[model samples]
Target: MNKLKVAVIGCGAISRLRHIPEYAANPNVEIVAFCDPNIERAKQYAETYKGRAYSDYETMLKQEHPDAVSVCTPNSLHARTAIAVAEAGAHVLVEKPIASTEAEALAMIDAARAKGVYLMVAQNQRMMPEHVRAKELVDSGRLGKVLTFRTSFGYSGPENWSVEGNGTWFYSKDKAIMGVTADLGVHKADLIRWLLNDEVSEVASFVGTIHKGGTDLDDNAICILRMKGGAMGSLAASWTYYGEADNSTVLYCENGVMKVGTHPEDQIILEMRDGTVERYRADDIATNAGQQSSGIIDAFIDSILTQTPPPIPGEEGLRSLKVVLAAFESQTSGKIVRMT
Candidate 1:
């Protein structure tokens, strides 16, 4: 079997911890190229992963002609990089929030379609063990219909985790656009949409830069979402938790409440109205302090090899991104924004 030639764009923290390592672990993948604005950083990863390094992605694409590319660039660069990779006739696995805007995301999708290449969004939360089990329980009708819910993702800040430390692009509006809302909020938004198998029809949100001093982008966000299935939920994303990160979700179903990532021993918990309780232990959710395989690389490679749709296709990413974009509109206008 000819191993798939894979390249990574942006040798950032995510690429270092997740994309590169995962791609290296896949027996069917051969790391062929790496690109980053910081040539030194790209060179370091290239040395470790046995790939050629380039400061410009276009040069790497032209020379390497990889079978697939992972776009790990900042939020603002996702659309353009992914579109270019697709136009180069390579599959794309772009980091989450897909693109800065809906128009950019649609353009990327169109590019991939025109090239007949796979375009996947790296929404890793959907692949988390606990969330996957939660989806199964919900689909089995074991939890009944989810009526109300709350999901939160919070940590100290990107300064602590990003490779650039306090001076990361996450703090820049031109580079990151929205702070925690896009960095963390999009994960919960995408997770909830997948878990409930529903579309967010309306959004109302409040976002502000409370802790981060240097940026105008928000560091905290609280969004209220109404699903097309009539499920209501609140999503909280913060960069001021002060302590350990909190990634938890609760679903209030007709029969009981389902809790995920709330307990150390039990990753998922179910409490019934009639006094029944169940506990489940699954793989721990990945955090900055302790990283784990996201299963995204394998899925992306599998989708391409099998000639099937990616697990999180570009359209699904667009829907999830629309929710985040609506939340931003709601915050700015001080009015509920209905999803169109």
Candidate 2:
């Protein structure tokens, strides 16, 4: 079997922690090039992976000609980089929230389609064994009717994501465009949508920075989602949670409730109304669990080799982004925003 040649476009923390390591471990992938605006970082990554290095993507695209590229840039730069790589005839695995806006996401989609290359959003949570199992339980009618759900994702802000610390690009309204709602909110939105197998048609939300000093972006947020099946759900995301606890999701059904998060060996917990509880732990879950970037890389390879659709397409990512955006809009308007 021929290994798929791939490039790591942004040699940042995400690339180092997720993409590079995951691809290195995978037998079917070859690290062909590393590109980063920071030349030193690119060189470092190339050295680490035994790949060529370039500070400019065009040079890398022309020289290495990889089969795929991972766009691990900031939220604002996702669309442009994705389109450029796809135009270079390499499939794109873009980091999520897809893009800052629907228009940008659609443009990327159009570019990828026109170039006859695949464009997939790296929505890794969907690949978590716990999440997959939960969705399976819901879809298999084992959970019966899902009445309501409360899901949340969060972490302390990245250590050096920006120069401003808490007031970095993540907090900058101009660069980030959205805050924790964009960072962590999108994950919960995607998870609930996948679990319910429906889109959020309407949303009402409240988002603000109650903590995370100097950060202009919201440190905390709560949103109510109305799914197409009349299932009412709530999503809460935050960057203010201190210590080790990070991401968590809970789904309440007519029969039972399911829970999963950062727990080791007992990530999935099911509680029933009958005072009985069951716990499930799957070894198939990725080491990073929900870091999402690695899953996206693996899925991109599958899409390229097998010609199968990615677990998370750009459109699906766009939908999740739309939900997060609608939540922000609703927070501003103080009314339910239809996700049209």
lDDT of 1 by residue, 1-340 (tens): 9999999999999999999999999999999999999999999998898989999999999999999999999999999999999999999999998999999999999999999999999999999999999999999997788999999999999999999999999998899987899889999999999999899999999989887898898999999999999999899999999987999999999999999999987999999999999999999988998899999999999999999999999999999898889988998899999988
TM-scores of the candidates in the order shown: 0.99, 0.92
Top TM-score: which candidate number? 1
Off by over 4 Å in 2: 160-168, 262-264, 283-294
Give me candidate 1's TM-score against the actual structure: 0.99
Report every candidate's CA lDDT. 0.94, 0.81
Q: What is candidate 2's TM-score against the reference? A: 0.92
Worst 10 residues of 2 by lDDT: 284-293
Tens-digit lDDT track of model 2 for 1-340: 8899999888776788888898998889999999888888889877878988898898889998899999987788888889989999999998878999989999999999899888888777788777877777778886678888788776666544443354445666666677889887998898888888888989999998896776567889999989988889888887766665466777888888877764667878888888798888864344332444335667778788999877788889999999988988998999999877
| Per-model tally of clashing residue pairs | 0, 0
The deviation in Å at residue 257 for candidate 2 is: 1.9
